[model samples]
Target: MLFLTRRRKVQREGIDYEQIDKEWDWDHFLILQAFVGATVFFLFPSLLHGLPLWDLRGLMVAMVVHVGVSEPLFYWAHRLFHKGYLFEHYHSLHHSSKVLQCFTAGFATPLEHLGMCGVMAAPILGATLMGFGSLGLVYGYILFFDFMRCMGHCNVEVFSSRLFESLPFLRYIVYTPSYHSLHHMEQDSNFCLFMPLFDALWGTLNNKSWQLQKDVSSGKNDQVPDFVFLAHVVDVSFSAHSPFLFRSYSSMPYTFKLILLPLWPCIFIVMLVMWAWSKTFLVSFYKIRGLLHQTWVVPRYGFQYFLPFAKDGINDQIELAILRADKMGIKVLSLAALNKNEALNGGGTLFVNKHPNLKVRVVHGNTLTAAVILNEIPANVKEVFMTGATSKLGRAIALYLCRKKIRVMMLTLSTERFLKIQREAAPEHQEYLVQVTKYQAAQNCKTWIVGKWLTPREQRWAPPGTHFHQFVVPPILSFRRDCTYGRLAAMRLPKDVQGLSVCEYTLDRGVVHACHAGGVVHSLEGWTHHEVGAIDVDRIDVVWRAALKNGLKPV
Candidate 1:
């Protein structure tokens, strides 16, 4: 549920992947070892032989000891760890992570973890020493302790402020994720083990805990993004890759998951529900050089783009998303994947034409798409095969490459469309643009720029050692083992990108689709023009250079 909901996140900032990589394994191993040791020790017949299997009396005693003895002991120990040498050497490690997650609960130095283990064992030992100990009491208390520890460090505010407002006493009894997050942030306050009551008694509680919890739980802290990447779902299987569903899954390139096969029916139902009822919704968000960047999903699938009946509905969603971004004061809104399909919305020209005065720049971002694709072509090579040769990106690539005096075999049946694109090139270079009616014409070309899908049979037409660079949606399958395939155009984000725990579709960490990078470049340059409609072949290099200047490297 925490993964599914955005408003519940207490910190708004993303988890630090680098810190997790460094600390997560060791921390979890230590925690697991501690738990295993405790379990093994308690399983001894000599130690717990006389204990009853169940005892309500011992449970009540354990709760009393937890409040009266355990809380105060841990509270003082935690406070001591904050002062002088203990903090500098031990407790500071735990506090080092500015962002917290579930694993963060165990991310402490060995000595500090040992101290915590002792604190957790206190109530169990106390109850057992009183001759009222039970197996159930020991197991229940230890598990409850661990559960509360994990909950407090989860960094998602699960409990609403109203829960405390109605039963105000509960606030002192149990600490919350928001409460502990304050402790991590401020370092000196909110130091207590699962109970804020001790902090209140010791005058160490942060006063703003309740208000911050209220604000975060109510989503008042979610700021408007400076840039929005208007994206769409690719397919049912790929929908499971949403960051809201699984962080680890979304952080890598997408592949067909056999594990997801069982869930396909349920996922299909969700897609249907989304198609019927959902509008544009926030998928994920991060910061690039302090400017907020958000990705909002269009709720339509990729195949839907080709559906004649679905076109109007998809366009409506796109227009609505663009208008919503403008109203939110977003500086740039880039259309990703099929959201900028010319046949559907004329590369976002429909929205820009409808709303003539939109403050937010509606960018198709195909200029950079064309640029990335064009740049990937081997410069020394004189000729290349081009598929989807008359499409928006294809036209730009064909024209741009022809201007370089490179021979381009544009595979298209429409002579009119081929001639139109060829005419856009310089008169001296126009002769380099040749129209081909079949893929067989590309048998000799080693460099093939694909903007259309190719079947395995059609792929056979390519010569050995041919490399296929693609910009097609649901990228073409690699059927020829002898040839190489280039992935969809993507660019690595600036190194300063922060809070970016989620991947953009199948792209790897810190890499985003070229269209998405285009928007970032637009915002970084503070360009006021809307990059809608046809791709300007001239600005392709300009955008590419600006992207490099802003630290966006081609992938």
Candidate 2:
């Protein structure tokens, strides 16, 4: 944000969002600014009782300094500024001219001005009464952040135009004239009264942390629809809902990195640790492959995947999935939910028949533990095709596989019966399920009834309504009230799917997914799936082995 704000042209949602807000009386603002600064500075040292408050709890004090004081003050005061009557009294001036010019900064209502004073009011008075020197970090931070505010609010862009064009780092050192420009023009634009972190975190920030990316991306609109706006509120209340419609954490701001780091090393360390862990799988790919004494296999639904190992011709669905995958060039580990001791290379047509190149290994079905899934995924996985598991199980498996750094296809069956069959077999997949039975009718799902429903017996393959062919591209749920089971049996969901508990599992690269209906090859090549596709038994045994032996597979 600071970077773009340094520019000369007018832009909305630029770092200058504050510039667009109601104008504060220059005298009042300056007075308040100086008064607040002087008061905090002189009185703050009194809180230490002639001792330092930093000794006992540095972090706790920093918390009290910023969160305990500044955060709540800004939130409530900003709320006050938005209130109708009070806003009209003092706040209106700040917002009077929505399309603010560069000079419009430092503009605030007088009452709003009092809130600024409140910054040091507590610390100074409290420190004086407590018979200690003003030692709290809140005081120091208030001084530092507030001074920046005054400087940032200055209508003047501090550097020469030529200097800014050449040296980008100057943008970081100062909040340029352009930074506050977005605040005044756009209603929902900049609201970070004195701090930039909130705006960055809430996706409301108007400028870039570094000046470099400004021209390419820093312009901000800040307007949101009623639904998106409402969702933001709900997201704060629910962690799962925080899916990051606009996630800045993945890409944080400089204030968080530079300012907060001094006082928050743990946070910095955590970020570093997370960084190392993410690339760990990538860096150690060959090492993990060398430890590849055994390969892991995850069996799909319809395959009735069982222990006696390959004892079941693999489930029909499983074979079908494999056949479909073979055509698409996807290779994957089929984990059996029922067996914990099983190895990835164990039992199956590939293991016993033994294709010279195609090596089959079995793996513990639970190899995808919650914790492992939480962290990293193996980099070797090319594509993942999963079908017929409980939503929870699917998620667990997906989560596990994803952490291994592998992307999963997350094959889904729209019908409850299909899901149930998958559930009975694997019983533990996670993701979404739209009970087609509840939408249509129980008889709609019955093969016999479906057969009868078709106009001509010869065309009974998929029938009309229940055909899986229609949703191959994107699954859209259609529910009929009368056809639906009672609410008890009805799958609980929002009135509209957009409102439902939606969680998207990202498919990883190199993994081809062959779903039940078809298009498995399309989704595979489209996404660059890595697993070699093997069709007929011979293809699975011979072709796949040859590639595996040659250290290259069609995937």
Candidate 3:
């Protein structure tokens, strides 16, 4: 592990297929379910058979609409179902059983699951009856979607070189286990049906999120909620018998009351306590934030919260300076930003990358604080921005430093087009710093002004008007090509160096002092993947004082 020296990095888990049986099938269940679905399908046609426009063209349109349109739409809706209130009150059951059995494929709270299926199927059914009848296309739609829906639930991981995935246009077009399994994994982002065309087109599909899952230690598994774990067990063991299908009303009213009477008291108490918890701050909010805030774990854009005047304009920065204060090893992140896809595609600021060091903070309030990706910043950070789009929360600190006279670089999140056209190509960091600017979402990417990273020393040195540049990323090799040299290079920080990218650019004057990655790898200049269990990078540790009770006061 050249990467894991005395330093610690987060753990990454890959696909764990041990729980999924490749050969497993529920033919009888499949047949039965298909019968039920078909019965519904035919019933619609029969009911409307006497309608003026009953025809097969409508059916074709319906199938196509379902496969191409409805599927991806469901993916978007499903992702929401996995979050917040939806997760706790609705969708969690489907995933309660981590080990899914074939029969459990469609098992769900009848009202919730069945209701959604009907809702999803309605549009297609309507479209079909109005016009569709092309046999080959319609059958293709049915067979293809059926297999994917079944296998989507199966634990099997396959690399079948099927046409949709093997052919060029189609290769990236289809959704496979390698593409959809992430739905059952961490349960975020990977929203797509058997087809990825719509999902990918919208930038909402999580293709990369679909890598096979690796098993965490069984011990860790035990730590997850018990209800979830039990669901998996039952999914594998039981068929979809109605939870109350067999229970008849043979129970007289008094007996029924006797059976449900205990539950009422328990439910009442639970509701009362829940009501109290909501009105007070006694809920496990912090713990809940830790366990549920997936955004906290995304490393790359995580630190936007720490940047000073990160997204605020000049006026806002001045106002914010009234508010606070606050990168890369020699592998200077020449630049980086948070790019929201919907807007600001044209480009603005330069971000950095291809380095080994960065210190980031999470940006709160519609800025770029996705993850705190500071892996190699120590390896090349000299002139650093304590804040990125993700670290906008650090604005006050950056502002304070600025009030103390530090010129901080305000970088815009990155983009592909702006980068492709740059005269002197800004290494990777600049690319990451571009923020897409749009209306509903003001931040599409981050754009930085050159003055952001000027150091205190640079402010005073030399005569006025001279150019003093900060960490401008230099071209370097990618990880697959130079992993070792990159790290050892970090180890080689010159003892005499103050810092790699650390610089004092007094453009109002002239002092060209460069900073090194690790204070001084001795650099005149410089330079930056994962696996396995629930590999977690130690979260950013923040200190909080106990209110007045703890003798701590709010500033």
Candidate 4:
């Protein structure tokens, strides 16, 4: 029934029909239960002994009496369920979906549902006992109650300010969609559903509810994307394989390599089949709620399928997520680590070429990451060591250091790339050197920033006092027998930032990686419409502001 309303839907920010479809599975159960309950109560009612139908005046009185009594009863009952054990066992079920829908209002455990039913029925039952109730009043209350509940549960705000503007006092008596939405989001406020009267009286009203109600009512986020998805894939083979397997696979006996080569096609076919069949749909929905109110939906593709054998699968998956994000109206999207590498190098080029209509601007987010890393580097340190000199991030950092006239040691496997970077450097800064070496060569440096490609074992080589910075997911692992190493991490911005919009992830502990953080920064700045690829040093302050706002203390 609610799905029909979605056809000519209220325009709100972050309404993903795909996400709605995924959640609709649970609505069937709720609908079926409601149908059974209605059938039992009305069609074959054993409880309504004699239908003592009442007139219009009696119905009006019953409505007034119902609100007066039900408010306090429902308030206390709701509060009690939120207490310790009851919350963990029952109330949490209702709180699970922070992004509510009309059908979701009735989506609760049988016990909780029964409790609500009893609370609503109490006033009507009392009126019946006093011989003042009618079948008309009972049915009227049921329909009206269901309508109000749906309005409250619907994520879209339904109330206009005109009525409230005329009568400001109505806010105390009438709760809006945002009133109930805040309860789902904060869990501690807006406890009274019938009216804010009880919640206000008991000091349980959320401080931000009124402001949020005003914001949503004005359609603040109507133009912006409802959610932004950060898409990436894991290296399953790298995770699953042993170090020996990697070495052996790279340089095995010529005959053995020949034997394995024949199976390559078979492996590819199997991987393709698995990827085709796999459900590359919605992975998770994140409800970000601190500084701003919004939702981020992450839809995953089976990108890790052809791992160790081939990397072609990654491109397909990135494309899949990109198309999906576009459909979800995610104006700004960032590719995570390997996904970025694949997309920018070739797949990304092909995608933009093929789909000119796609409005989503893809960003690698390397600009802010480099800025965060540079800002974090100690001023006292004399030299900086960096691996993956050929990577976009490495190149940006290397160029930045060259311009600053600081000593930097850029390490890479390609001798040609090293020479090209060194040759391009200013003649005055010969100290900005490039070398073809591994992690071992950077031992003497006090500052170490490595790419994501470095293994856990290789990372442990950083000297004792060295402040190691890694801009990678799963972060740099520490295998030190004794926990005594100086490690640095990206930091979150203060709650109050001067001269900058406070845009940040509500969760992730303010600890978001540079790539995803970049997109978030762009979104906050209202620059989702523009394309951002390699950020320049002069304009790195955008990333700085975002990092400061979203960054947490390094772990």
Which candidate, 1 or 2, has the higher lDDT?
Answer: 1
Ten contiguous residues minimizing lDDT sum, candidate 4: 498-507
Q: Give residue 289's error in model 1 in angstroms.
A: 2.9
The deviation in Å at residue 261 for candidate 1 is: 6.0
Best by TM-score: 1
Tell me the deviation in Å of residue 485 in model 2. 99
- lDDT comparing candidate 1 with the true structure: 0.84
443-501: candidate 1 lDDT, tens digit per residue: 89899998889999999999999999999887898889999999999999999888776
Candidate 3 segments exceeding 4 Å error: 1-59, 133-144, 161-166, 207-555
RMSD of 3: 26.2
Q: How accurate locally, in lDDT, is each candidate?
A: 0.84, 0.34, 0.31, 0.59
Model 4: CA > 4 A from native:
1-227, 233-274, 277-313, 320-330, 342-350, 353-358, 436-438, 453-460, 481-508, 528-538, 545-555
Q: Which candidate is the best by lDDT?
A: 1
Tens digits of per-residue lDDT for model 2, 394-439: 4344444433444444434455534453343222433322223222
The worst-scoring run of ten residues by lDDT in candidate 2 lies at: 225-234
lDDT of 3 at 497: 20
Judged by lDDT against the true structure, how good is candidate 4? 0.59
Q: What lDDT score is found at residue 48 in candidate 3? A: 38
- Candidate 2's error at 98, in angstroms? 7.1
**Who is ahead in lDDT, 1 or 4?**
1
